[model samples]
Target: MKRISLFLLVIASLFSTKTVFSQLILGPDTLCIGNELQLSTTVTNASTYYWGFCSAYLKNLPAGSSIAAGTGLAGPSSIAMAKDGNHYFVYVVNATAPRNVIRYEFGTSLSNVPLATDLGNFAGSIPVNPKGFELVNTGGNWYGFLTGGATSITSDIIRFDFGNSLSNTPTIVDLGGLVLNPQDLYVFKEANNWYALTNNGFSGNLIRLEFGNSLTNTTPNVVDLGNPGSLSDPSGMWPVFDGTDWHLFLVNRGTDRLTRLDFGTSLLNPAVDNDLGNPSGLLNQPRDISVIRDCGSYYGYITNENSNTMTLLTFNGAVTALPIASDLGNFAGFNGPRYLTRFLRDKDNVFAYTTNNADNSISRLEYNTCSNAAPPISTLQTPPPVTYATPGLYNVYFASDEGLPTMQVDCKLIRVLPHPIIEVNNDTLICQGDTILLVANGPGLFSNLWDPVYNTIAPYDTTSIFIYPKEDYRYNVHLEFTQGGGCAYDTSVFVRVSRITADAGEDRL
Candidate 1:
C-alpha cells in the first residue's frame, strides 16, 4: 500500500509540471490609446466575454495591478482595437452559424457599457474551428484572415474585406488546402511585398505565405518552415523586425518551451534557437504569447494554461537571441488563461489581458504603480508653478507633497527662455572723494542691486547706488530682480575715476 501511494504521487507531479501561456493577437493598425490601458479578453465555451480598463499610471507595480472596472460580453474569441480610438471590433464564433463580427464603442470612462453592434459573418459561411486571426491592410483597403477548422472542408483560412464598417458581409477567399490545418495567422509587410504566416498544429510547421500585389489573391506562394528547434505542438507565433531581419518566436505546448526562428532578409531560409528551455519547471504548457517594444527593449508576455499564471520575458533588442523569463505566479480568479493582448504604444503604463477557458472569465493584468493605484489628489495645489529661476538646459519634475502616485508628476525637459533683456548705463567719470550714482534699465524689472557692496538706503529695491572712492578706482554695479527667484540679472556697469591735480608750490601761495 505504501509503494502504491508513492507511485501515485510521482505521476501527479509529472502531469502538473507543464503550464499554459497566451498569445495576444491584435488587429492591424491598432494603437495604444491615451493615458489609459484597455484590455478585452474572450472566454471560450462560455456565454459571456469580458473587458477591463486600468490607468496607465500603475506601470511600476506589475503584480499589484488591479482592474478599475470590467464588463462582460455575450461571447467573443478575438478582439481588435480600431484605428479610431473610440471603437473596437470582436470576432464571435458560433457553432450553429457563420461567425458574427461585432463592434463596440467606449463610453466617457472605461466602463464596460459598450454600445454593441453586429457586423454579420464571413460570407455567410461558418468555419468549424476558428482560432487565431489578425487585421491587415492591402491596396488601400482593410482585410482579415482567420485560421482554424479541419484540413480543408472546415479548416479553410478565410479572408474577409471590410468596405467601410464591419457592418457589411465580407467577401471570403479560402487559403486552407494549401497551408493545411493552420491554427493561427499573422500578416506583415516587407518593402513592397505582403506576407502571411501561420502555424499548422497537426504538422508542427510555420508556413510563410506571400501575396502577389493583392491580399485577395487566391493562391499565394507558401514556404513551409518545418518545426524549428524540433518544436512540438506550436500553439502561438509572433515575428518581429529587429531593424535588420525578421525573427520569429513561438511557444510549444507539448514541450513546455519557447523557441526562436530567424529568417534573414528573406523567409525562404531560416535558423532556429532555443530561447527558454524548461528549467525550474516554470513553463507548463504555455498556450499564447505577445511582444511589445518599450524603451528600446522588447517585452514578451505569455499565459500559462495549466498553472493559471503569466510569464514575463525581456529582450535587449527588437528581436532577441536569448531572453530572461520570470513567472508572475497566479492571480485571483484566473483559470486556464488561453489568449492575451497588450497595449503597444506606452510602455510606462503597460497593460495586457488573458482569457481563461476553465472558469469562463477574463483576467486583466497591468504593470507599474501608476496603473495599479489611483491618481492621488493632493490637498494642496501641487505642481505649484514654481519658477525655474536659474535655467540653462534642465529636466524638471513635478510631484505632490506626499510624493505618491499623482497626476501632478510630469517629468519633462524644458528650456526656460532667458530672462527679460536688461542694459546698464555706460562708463561714467567721477572725481576722487566723490560719489557717483549707478543706474540700470530692463523690461519687467521689479528691483535692482549694486554689486561690490556699497551703502544704499534700499539696496534691494533701489535702482541706483552711490559709491565714494578715496583714490582713482573703477566702480562696478549690477542690477537684480525679485522675479525669477532673484536669478534674473543685468550686466555690470563700471564707473571710471577722474584725477584732479593741485599745484601750490609753483605759485608761492
Candidate 2:
C-alpha cells in the first residue's frame, strides 16, 4: 500500500506539469492563401509542443484532421507553409538558445500526422531576436523578413528557396543604415518595382529598394514631402500611379490625418492637394494604405491603428474631400490592426484581410452584390415653375428620387424626386430685334416655349431656339419632356430686348 501511494503521488505531479505546459501562447499570427491558407502562430512559452492547421472553415475542428503536426524541443518564433503538389510542407524555428535552428515537418494529408522525415537545421544561426516578419513569394520561392535583435544593428531579409528540400543557406539582405530598430517590414510590388516599408521613423529617410534579377543597391533613394506646417510624423506611405500621375497616401502620426501627395511632374517634391484634404473626422493613427483599382478610378483602404477602423478614399483626379469609412467588422474585438490588403474574390465579391497585431489574428471580410444595386436616379423639382430674375448662384431645393435618408434604400414604390440644381448658367441676354440662340442643357426635358407660363410654343426642338424680343421683357424658357410621367417642366430665365445702338448710328460714329 505504501509503494502504490508513492507512485500515485508522482503521477499526479506529472499530470499537473503537463497541463500547465499545454496552454498555448500565441505571438503575432499571419494568414496567406494559395491552394490552401497558410496560418502561422508564434509560440513563446514551451520548447516542446505540437501544432497543426485546422481549417478556419470548420467552426469546430475535429481532433484528428489538420494539415501537419510537429514537435520541437525549442520554442518557435515563426512558421511557414509551402505547397508540395497537393500537400503542404511545414517548417518551424525549432530551437533558439544554444544556436538558432529550424526543423521541418511534412504530411501527405491535412490530418494531424507526425512529420515523415526530420530535416535538421535548414538555416544556420537563426537570428536571436526577431521583431516582425512578412512572407513573400518570388519566382516560385518563399522568403521572410527577420527584424529586430540585440547587438543586431539591422534587420535581415532572408530568402528560402524550396526545391527538393528547403535551402540551407538563405541570402541575407541587411537593412542596417536604412531602418533604425525596425519593428515591421512589408514588401509590395508596383509597376515592375518591388518596394519595402519599415516601421522605423527616419523622417525623410524612407528606404526605396528595387529588386529584380538581383537585389539592387541598398542605398535607397529618399524623398521628403515637406511637412505642411504640422509636426505629424509620417506613419506609412503607399505610392500609386493613376496612369497619368503618381499619388502617395501618407498616414500622419501626429494628427491621425491622411494627406495626399501629388508627385507633381517629378517622383520627388510631392505637393499637397488641399482640395483633396483629409476627410474631416475619421481615422486615428492611420498606419497603412492599400488601393483597389476600378474602371478608371482607384479606391484606397487606410488602416487606422489606434481607432481600429478603415477609411475608404475614392480617388478622382483629386481625391474627393468626403471619404466613407465602411464599418467593416468591429475592431474593438480585434485591436491593433496594423495593415490591410484587399482582394477581389469573384466578379462581384471583394474581401479585405486585416492583420491585427495585438490579437495575433487576421480578420477576413467579404462584401458582395455591390454591382446589383440600383443606379442613381436624379430628379429636379422647382416651386411655381417660373424663371429666375438675375444671373447668380442660387441654392435649388432638391432630393434624390430614392429619398433624403442617409442609408441606401431599395425597391420602394415611391416616386421620389431629386433636388433641383441652380440654373445660373441657363441665363440669356439678347438685344431688341436681334436673334439669340437658346439651347436646352438639362436632361430629360426637350422642347422649349417662349411664354412665361410655358403656354406658347417656341420654334425649337429642345436643341436650340432663335429668340427675338422687341421690348425689354423677362422671358422664361420652359423645357418640355414626354416620358412615362408626361410633360415634366424646367424653367430658365432670360433678359431679352436689351438696349443697343443701331448699326447705322455705330458706322456714322
- Model 2: lDDT equals 0.39
Q: What is the lDDT of every predicted structure here?
A: 0.50, 0.39
Question: Given candidate 2, what's the lDDT at residue 491?
Answer: 59
**Model 2 lDDT per residue over 151-205, tens place:** 4353343433332333433545554444443433445555555555544444423
Off by over 4 Å in 2: 1-177, 181-204, 210-213, 216-231, 264-278, 320-333, 370-509
Clashing pairs in model 2, backbone N/Cα/C closer than 3 A? 66-110, 398-419, 398-420, 399-418, 399-419, 401-416
lDDT by residue for model 1 (48-119), tens: 221111223221336422232233332334443322222333333333345565554433222234455555
Instruction: At residue 125, give the lDDT of candidate 2.
Output: 32
By TM-score, how accurate is candidate 2? 0.42
